[model samples]
Target: MSRMILRALLCLPVLVAALAAAPSPARADALHVGLVIPQSGQFRLLGDHVREAFQVWDADNPGAFGDIVEGDDGCTPESGVDAAAAMIEAGVDIVVGFLCTESLAAALPILSNEKIPVMTLTVRADIIGEEAARLGWSFFRLAPRAGSEAEIAADAIYRFWADKPFALIEDGAISGRELVEAVRTRLEERSLKPNFVDNYRPGQATQPSLVRRLKAAGVSRVFVGGDRSDLAVIAAEAEHQGVALSFMGGDALHAPEGELPLPDGTMAVLASGVVPGPEAEAARQAFAAHDMIAEGLRIPAYAAAEIIGAAANRSDYGQTNLVDLLTGTPFSTALGPVTFDATGERQEPGFVLAILEDGKFRRLSVDDASRLTGESQ
Candidate 1:
């Protein structure tokens, strides 16, 4: 078996042990979890998915939570603070949902002041991540910090395009530029640098000039920091001119297919959330039972419930420090094993490489990644 697979197997039993720490009276003293998600806003559908996952988990394990207090964050600052206050007033043992950074920013301090630990399923931003440590807040993030996405994209490119002449191009937008800069910096740190670097206007119909420039630079491999549409246009232009180029992109490529289909062998760097492991497959099966697709924060919300409820059991049902247990233990979920570093950031295996095969991106293992040769035009 693969080392990761074996490690996953070992982690499962530890989680099973922790969740089973408390016995059948579990239904009586189960943790009172406060569900804080945006129930009345634009992102309400996302919150609904989280709630459904929680319901599924609750039904699957009858004694996991004694009661669930609903708090509507509305994905806004005012609502987040209101929700936090409401949960505190309700005497919730723990809070377990926050979808947006605005909500976390507004509510974490209040929750922390009350000594209530939060397990945020999403809400990953650099400022929030810094504040959590600088202010000593009591929330653990299952989602990765913002810049890690760029770092993961760089890792994938360096893995497959190390020796090949590769171009790092970006759309002129701030976020796209920042992404390319981050990727460039990471690769340069490892003594690898792109052969060509340039900025192209986003939302262009075609990128013939950019394709020709890349061809002139003698680059066959490219890492794009742009929207899905721009990347698709670039690839289409490259093929139209019969230029042999292989493109790698970040998560923006996960959007709905555009007018021009992404050519085969196009790769994307995705968070491990999308990585289909044995654990994730089981979650998918369960989600299928509920007719849910397990996208975005949905599965993570379910995993958060598993971690928090099981952590309460690991503790003396509130006698032990919940943060200490969460920080110190490696909890397993249908998504995979969850462990965090001292900074409260998740550890390695945070991202996976995915390849566009037959019009869809499929997650790849580390070994699966190393064997790839850049796709021929």
Candidate 2:
């Protein structure tokens, strides 16, 4: 062959070999995340918040390798199991959402069987941590448990009114009962006993009589386990009875400005995993950049996404190994830092105290309250 032809022929074979050895165009891998929440019932608002959070994160980081599949569990055990089966069949590698404990309990077995990692936003403390550890590395939580809230409330109570006799009240529901027991246990550990413990059915109109009974008990500090409306009613009744009581509970009491009907001198403490501050505001900005509104469940939902993303990123988007990622990696998100212990429980601390002022819940300074009662923060 001529010199130029020979050179061209050699280059053509080398180019062809290079083309054959090169990898195909990188196709975007879809990381399907299952969102198991109530979307058509009373818990629809919570579901909306969760979905908004996920949407916000997805928008900020477009094509970041994750998509959510809605699993409408309807806050029921049977529905939750059905939702889990559906998500598994749809090839979801990880699951998030489930505001109810009963639904989570029902869904756990199916998720475990499918080896799908679940990041629960529910506050049920007893379900996923040590319990799931015994089963496998398939469960996680972004929200602090109800028991942790109770414990934080107990600490806040000790700081606010260490010398005063207190009362523990529950609404007889699962969460309320658990909070009451948790606070009581912590009090006992400190060699203290509440002057009284009472249980009431929430939303009933008979709270006036209950307040009178609590007043008769001479309890100045009251820790009630219920929602904001229930606590507001109790606070109003206490005011009507001319009794001044300091009340505290979980983040359920946190409402927008001018929403709560608490009287003057009624101090409340709200326990939450995500403290609203600079970090939260930054997260809000990130979500807004994506044209999404930040809601109450936003932190937990994004934390779920980050948890999965961090795992995938570390593994270079390898296999659909969600359980392994959940077991091995700790995801730090906008809701402060998160690291799971051996029992699959997050070691993130919950917020301590927030008092009701001018119809709004204001975050209390631990220093001020601790000095008031000679307690350490």
Candidate 3:
């Protein structure tokens, strides 16, 4: 564990991170990490996953942190403020957890007063990013920025349907409209105009008219800036019409499927959350020992602990030095190398391309995308 901690901090080659290091007389006087996550609200389950992962990692690393002060984010502004106050009272050096954006937003100013740096596993709103840049808050995220989904959606469309004629469509919801507009703007900048661009009245049982229009446009592929339910309807309607139209959608594609599940070939570009692979072997073994699967927010939360251990080991480590080290240097973790950008967003948060096959979104690769989207006519 000590050697692994050292390798995680690739930038600080000369320093050996004290995570899981040999016990010493002063070992109890180590850094205290404050954990603030939703404990009594709709998002409680999310917070639980994060906390469980943190505990597993802490156990694996043993003497990595002096103490862990736990608090509830409450998943609301008032509760968030209370949680932050608890952290300050506990005199913690750094903070982790904070899955709720509202909770984190309300808590940041209080933490900023004490110059405490924060490490979030899953708060990825653009407003949080704007506030960080505007207020100069010391925040580091293991998640992508909000608009990353639209950018990734556009890139995936180009890769899969650049040669094949494809249409861009959206439901009238704000999220759907914005995603469609962003994708259209990006494609136009690259001189790739869609065969059709339109909005459909959402929440209908069927979309025969929309599917007819898609067939009329001679498009074999379509990108939907809408929810999974709406996409499911369109895909079903197209199949009913024998149009053979393939569909790609944004994060909303993962929503719970009602009676109509999305067609098998439907693809979605979802935000990069915790996609633990072979790099997470050690973490996986640790999780398995506890009878837990290394998945979901657990992976990233464990990665957060790794970042804290490695970053805290610097000779001149302090709250103020966190942002500099996190943004400028890369740290290896269960989720590959975690490097942040100026806005505290993960720089290389690659989107997950999932295909709705066998009633689930399976991770997809480029070769699989080609086969699923019917390979451009």
Candidate 4:
């Protein structure tokens, strides 16, 4: 009896090994995520960076996130529609990455009908406003809407010149005019008014008259609602005409293609990229390992994937549950805490105040502001 018991105990080790080697029934039913970005054509370079970022996220996470499906929109409207349709047919739980604006426009109807959720990294102004009004839910964005950028510009100006007099200027272009008005609207809410307001014609070699008028008005600071070229011309002419005043504007001032160098201490409002926090530094190293630069859509794409994976992990791995999880809860990412309103727009969206020095954007310290205030301080 003792010999027989010993043999049985030895057989128990083999049985346990076999069971451990076998796959669990639940392991076969893993969830899936779809990455829909441009993989070819003009924007393929950006798509490559996005893909590498996703891969970096995946490598760190391993199998906890399940399968990652790829869909190439080719950075075109037609391709985006087709890519979204294919992802749906393939049975992906959620979709992320829409770098192309037109592609997002075309793919929405298809994705919406199936009730599939999408987290886009595109930064077009109308996506959450006009587009959301029509599309309703099942769509969210990682980047701030373009229209909100103007409000950020206003906020930065207000914070910097709270006790000083300033003027609002535009270049007669629709975008420039709208930006100027947006800043004016924000300022009015605070019971503050611009000391002077003016609109100048664009593409002039110089704006000596406008500069002289601004100087004569005793304006020591000016906010220009125009691109860097117009700002360059105005600043150069202002300096030449002996008018000493600081300049601030929208993100256009950050453009490296300025015809003239922007003056030192010139400030602009731009959407904040992944701020220089601990998470951002970690991502920087991860991106470097893959021989890629972390910029533009890369950080957003990685954050979008993290958002989807987190929502899925919190749910029963069903598409419906995942959608509810995304809309109802906030996901903290490298970019910051991301929460969406009912219409799929980020709540409390704001912009960063970046100062231009030697043609580079140096972010300024500012407090986060409510979306209503239109600035993150």
Best by TM-score: 1
RMSD of each: 9.3, 7.1, 8.2, 6.6
Please, what are the lDDT tens digits per residue for candidate 4 over residues 1-377? Answer: 69999999989999999999987544323458787877778878777767777888888777656777889977678887898889898888777777777777777778877887777776456644567657574787777777788778777767666666789999888888888998899889988899999999988888889998898889888999888888888899988988888888886665666567888767887765633334566677778887777786677777776776576555355434666677757877766678877777777464566776566766664432232134223
**TM-score for predicted model 4 compared with the true structure:** 0.81
lDDT of 3: 0.79
Candidate lDDT (C-alpha), each: 0.81, 0.72, 0.79, 0.75
Candidate 4, poorest ten consecutive residues by summed lDDT: 368-377
Q: Count the backbone clashes (under 3 Å) in each candidate.
A: 0, 0, 0, 0
Output the better candidate (1/4) by TM-score.
Answer: 1
Q: Which whole-number lDDT from 0 to 100 does residue 335 have in model 2?
A: 68
Ranking the candidates on lDDT from highest down gives 1, 3, 4, 2
Superposition TM-score, candidate 1 onto the true structure:
0.88
In terms of lDDT, which candidate is stronger, 3 or 4?
3
Residue 335 error for model 1, in Å?
A: 2.5
Q: In candidate 3, what are the lDDT values of residues 29-82, reduced to their tens digit?
A: 357889898777687777877888878987877776888889988778898789
Over 1-377, each residue of candidate 1 has an lDDT whose tens digit, in order, gives: 99999999989999999888856553225778898887776888878878887888887778768888999877778888998999899888788887888877888899989988887777657778788889988878887666888888888777777888999999988877888999999999999999999989889899889999999999999989888889999999998999999889887777889898999888887766765566776667778888888886677787877887687666355456667777857888866888876656666555667888899888875655556644321
- Stretches off by above 4 angstroms in model 3 are 1-29, 314-320, 369-374
